[model samples]
Target: MQFENTLSFAKSLDLKDELSDYRSQFHFPKVNNKPVVYFTGNSLGLQPKRTKKFVDEIMADWGDLAVEGHFHASKPWWDYHERLAEPLSHIVGAKKEEVCVMNTLTVNLHLLMVSFYRPTSKRFKILCEEKAFPSDQYMLQSQVRHHGFEPSEALVEVAKRDGEHYWRTEDILAKIEEIGDKLALVLIGGVNYYNGQVFDMQTITRAGKAVGANVGWDLAHAAGNIELELHEWEVDFAAWCSYKYMNSGPGNASGIFVHERHLKNDKLQRFEGWWGTKKDTRFLMKPEFESTHTADSWQLSNPPVLSLAPYLASLEMFDEVGMEKLIKKQKLIVAYLEFVLREIDKETEGSFEIITPADRGCQLSVFLHGQGRKLFDYLMENGVITDWREPNVIRLAPAPFYCSFEDMYRFGQILKSGIER
Candidate 1:
């Protein structure tokens, strides 16, 4: 399993890669007339070539049938969002009835919080990771304020230890225990957007539930990048955006998972609408709200078909490839990327500290010591599409669906040269 910083070695890996051929299925952007080495799938995935066909079908349906397209189109627009549930359930490891496509990531999180984040005099605090994504930070703050509590009093943050880039599992579990009866909810990003760390969700969920708290995950970065068993893990609820790693278009619709136990519960509080009514009687327009008896009950309105069209296209690929094969390639490819980064660091006498820990997915967040923004610009100008965070960390996420081992090799060459320059 030794890796070499050589083109031949990289090509050898590609020759043996079963997923290599799938790379051509996507459309990569060109820089200098060459397809760029894409490392931003954790930010926005490369578009699938098949996406145009899916989108075209929708456009054609709307043109040919107009309003009747809702019932007569190839995939029937009225129940269009339902088509996503089964395949998406497989990706997130949930039952079909427990998952559904709906609003965007933060919107779904807020809706889910309305149901899961019931605070009382005894149990009123929510525990989340410190420095969560800005959207998540805003969502939690607003939710707490809406419930008539100060964020300083109701939000409990588990911060990384001094000099640490990743969160410790023991610290999180201990924090849950410390919160004990006061903990109302534990919602965190399943894969940290900053460091690319995949938290021990199962362990953390168990600890949260044991402490009488509801546990959930924002899987925006975890959903397609890593293996998840949300159902088996007993996660109360979860949500994820489809753009990153999922290869849906930018800012596409999101998917949600509400545990089966909560599916038909009468006590759960959610903002509901007619689309969430049971399908058999939905057109009847009854005054009372009847739950769809699934995660679809969380929908506030009919889906935006244009956005869902691209997502449905992406899920088709996931159904074809399955998560098992994707994760198999992900592990090998990310390991090779780490090796290449180390090799470059040694060759250029550059101090590259990978902040992403062993518990990571496709992303490798490296702290580029003694280097500045010029190195990032050099790589970007040279056709390596990566992401730069504040400070000195650059997130390189070589999505296994399209990226080959040679990308790792070439990126190393770019890094070495950028440092030497």
Candidate 2:
């Protein structure tokens, strides 16, 4: 397990990779007539080769049998959204009835908060990580304001220690105990988008439950990249976009999870639509809303077949290899990336620092001691696809699905040269 910088080390690791062949399954983008290294899957995944054909099938159905496509065509567009529940459930570690694929990530977050974030005089505060993704911050602020509570009074943001880059687990647990009485809900990201730190969902859920709080997760960065047992973890609800590690297309529909314990809980309220009504009598146009007895009761309208088709194709691929196998491979790749990053930092003598945690997921956020923007642009011009965060920090994600060990090594070589110049 010694860290080495030679190309031979990368080749040896690549040869031992079981999922190596899956790299060709994606349509990697090209630059100067060559495939880009594609370290940006943390933002948008590379498209699957089968994505076109998956959408084509639905397009053909719509073209050949316009109206019938809704009810009688192959896969039947009427119940198209239902077909994804099983695969989506498998990915998030939930029962089929407890999960539903619908809406975008932010939209689903808003909808889930509506049902899970009910506050009262005694318990009205929402606990979340400070510097959460902008959308999440906005969502939390608006939700608190909508409930007639001052955001400053109702939102408790957990921040990192003064000089530290990541929040400590002990501090978070202590905060839960300190304010458990006034807390109504805990809504935070499964993997921090900015720093790639993976939060302890199990401990967080346990802490929240002890304090009489409903808990939910925004899994935008964690769903496909890590192993999760949401059902066993007793998470009340969660939602995620599939475009990141899930390899679904950009702006793809997202998935949501609700614990089975809440399936019949009458206290839980939702913004209902006709699509969420009992399917057996949905076409009857009943005036009263009779929600389906599962997570599908949150659906607001019929799914877009084209969007869902690509997700179905991607989820099938996820089901084939399985999450455990994917995560095992990911740990190896990211560990290698971290090792190489450290080597570069040592070579530079404190010119840059890795802000992301060592035990983080695939991403590594590099903070340059000086100007990071120029270094990021230099790397991009040299054909490295790493992203630059504001002020400092270049985020590099050597994704498991398509990235090779050589990609990591090559990135290190280029990064060293970039910073030195």
Query: Which is the leading candidate under TM-score?
Result: 1
Q: Where in model 2 is the C-alpha error above 4 Å? A: none
Clashes of each: 0, 0
Lowest lDDT block of 10, candidate 2: 28-37
RMSD of 1: 0.7
Off by over 4 Å in 1: none
User: lDDT of all the models against the reference?
Assistant: 0.94, 0.88
lDDT by residue (211-306, candidate 1, tens digit) is 899999999999998999999999999999999999999999999999999998977999999999999999999999999889999998988999
What pairs collide in candidate 2? none
Q: Residue pairs in steric clash, candidate 1? A: none
Highest lDDT model number:
1
C-alpha RMSD of candidate 2: 1.2
For candidate 1, which ten residues in a row score worst on lDDT?
343-352
TM-scores for every candidate against the unseen true structure? 0.99, 0.98
